[model samples]
Target: MLKISEVCCEDEYDSMKNYEKTPVLMKRAPFWSGAAVQNAKLVNISMKDFINKYMVLIFYPYDFTIVCPSELIQFSDRFEEFQDLDSELIAVSTDSQYTHLAWTTTPRQNGGLGGMNIPILSDKNHRISKRYGVLDEELGVPHKAIFIIDNKQILRHVSTSDMAISRSVDEVLRVIKACQFVDKYGNVCPMRSPCDDDTCESKNTKDND
Candidate 1:
């Protein structure tokens, strides 16, 4: 079996100094808005609009970079899996929306993003990255970070990595499934216990669907 990825508390809640961890855990996620390019269209979107849905905010360093494009395209390819599980996935970068569209429209053979199914949000001003605590101040780009917000708008999980490391799409899927399982059954998920694992009685039966 593949090992599940581990996330650090510091990476998850770096901005929560002087506050109780419990309260911080229950606090609503910070609100944000920016232009996004999705399915070859540009539009305005906000975090508030995704209320009542599981929201995954993926923060990467930049567009037109090697590691970033693979991650974005992977997530875009598996986007419907998130939707099927009642979640929304959004990719955020400091790149402008116009750049996002250009990259998506560019052919993959030319080392471009070809096509992207999910929204790629523009955080060109870095406000959202700063608020999320993923900004690399010296570099003016965010660290590789993933924030999973539950239906109530409470942030449930967060993971961050340095530029050299890439995140696992499979691991992210397992996490959201675990979150949903716990939310439905009120049972705790042990470490490495994926929702589909037979050992976990809390596993959802409909998971095979």
Candidate 2:
């Protein structure tokens, strides 16, 4: 396995690209790693770290953009909701970790993300984005996309949108709930409504102690 390091050589990247196949629904997600800015510090993060828990990868076009901050901050504010559901949200962009940190330090009033609750992953090499097939060849940035990986590392859901559009975090949460419901109960979840306590645990219900 090609573990992500602070400075992955180009040869390593090529080997990874060739070694790993493209991501497919209901299949294991492609393993990836890179530097991430979390809580004002740079850290090495990888898909391996998120194993045994649901991982939500949110790939946005860029930092300091109009719709990007809104989506990021919303996810950050509602991070506990995801945590309650046994999931982690990771925000990724082509921007460098330093840029991610700078944007985090900037206030929302001035169009900054403001100390995000989730780790902001830097896809500066563009390899991770490309491996996921969200990279825009023309724009040199990723399209707004979300990949939900289950505890078993199987990709359960994926959504992609153009740069002009922003994703619905609530909808993502509902989908996650539905995914969990299906996994736990082996029943079909309704399209519009989330699985309630009658069929499965309520979204508000925290994990049992």
Candidate 3:
């Protein structure tokens, strides 16, 4: 997997830096006692499933939309990579489970994500999205938001982008790995490399006027 620096361009890196510092409160992942897609019964999806495990929570704009399917399929194709890192992928939208099932059952040629192993959580009431501050009240759909929650249920990383742009799956995996590295080593990250001359290393480093 590519490092976070390679995955994100300079502008994206600056944006992510600001985003990381923003104080946005995230609600705990909901425990839903509802039916999963394809007639699979689900009592609830708890934080425990992700507590000790790395997790990627993806909140899309909406289902059955123009850009949604492409992003979904891209994530599905790389799902194994996430699994290799011992992370669970939970995709959420305001769409109902019936809609999720229909989309999953539909062929990829027909713009549906066929046979996706990742769990698609329903936020039909907008409760979850609202809690995450991704809900677009006017459109009633979620904006593109991704959260990397560590094993302890603490919000480690959060990002939201325009509805049009699809997120980088590789970068998401990298962040998860970085977070896991931090968790294991306490402070130092194996992937944190020395800054180059052009990069600022301290808060006191001033840009040349």
Candidate 4:
């Protein structure tokens, strides 16, 4: 197995066409996840499973890295916050399950995931990351990508950022809240949304600017 410092070679799936893909409702996402046993423990992570709720997928390039750990821990820290909003968060990368397990067992002070229980999907072949169009062929890793899938499994929001910058978990939650708000009220959610949450107030200022 290759270590984190080793760069990956370019492969067949290095096309830009797959990025920002919009999936049809009830369609199964093209990837396998969960603990990788000898047979690869694939989860039934279909669009149908998350009905009447929301789904958030964060795609990072590799595991046991700097920005990645910070982002994953933050999501794990706020896992219940997402749950409270009837949403699920799934983190993915091009690393294998064994790699994920090793990293998760490592502590945050040691630059690891600090034993986060959030489902970290393994895409060792970059098949899933490429299908979602988050892979970076040059670096052989996925981009800092965040995707919001609605309860019906339709791909609603897709955005990417530099790997050097860690994403704001609060921003992600705010967007999901807005998505939910729109679904229920059928009107645009104000940037501030009248919510008393600290994230709401701070994010609103940025939203307006």
Best model per lDDT: 2
- Give the clashing residue pairs of candidate 3, or none: 51-151
Q: Candidate 2 — which residues are off by over 4 angstroms?
A: 1-22, 201-209
Position 34, candidate 2: lDDT? 90
Shift of residue 201 alpha carbon in model 3, Å: 23
Estimate the TM-score of every prediction.
0.82, 0.85, 0.72, 0.73
Q: Comparing candidate 2 with candidate 3, which one achieves the higher lDDT?
A: 2
Enumerate residue pairs that collide in model 4: none
Q: List the residue pairs that clash in candidate 1.
A: none
Can you write out model 3's per-residue Cα lDDT over 65-174, one digit (the tens) per residue?
A: 77888877788778899888788888888888888888888777887777787888887877566656678889998889898865545577889998878788878877
- Model 4 spans with C-alpha error above 4 angstroms: 1-51, 194-209
Each candidate: RMSD to true structure?
A: 8.2, 5.7, 11.4, 10.3
TM-score of 4: 0.73
lDDT by residue (tens digit), candidate 1, 87-148: 99999999999999999999988878988888999999887887787888799988898999
Please report the TM-score between candidate 1 and the true structure. Answer: 0.82
Where in model 1 is the C-alpha error above 4 Å? 1-23, 191-194, 197-209
Residue-level lDDT of model 4, residues 16-114, one tens digit each, is: 344335433334333323333122233434333455567888889888777788888889888999999989888888887788777877777887776
Q: Tens digits of per-residue lDDT for model 2 on 34-137?
A: 99999988999888777678999999988988889998999999999999999999999999999999999998899898878999999998888888888887
Sort by lDDT, best first.
2, 1, 4, 3
lDDT of each: 0.80, 0.83, 0.66, 0.68
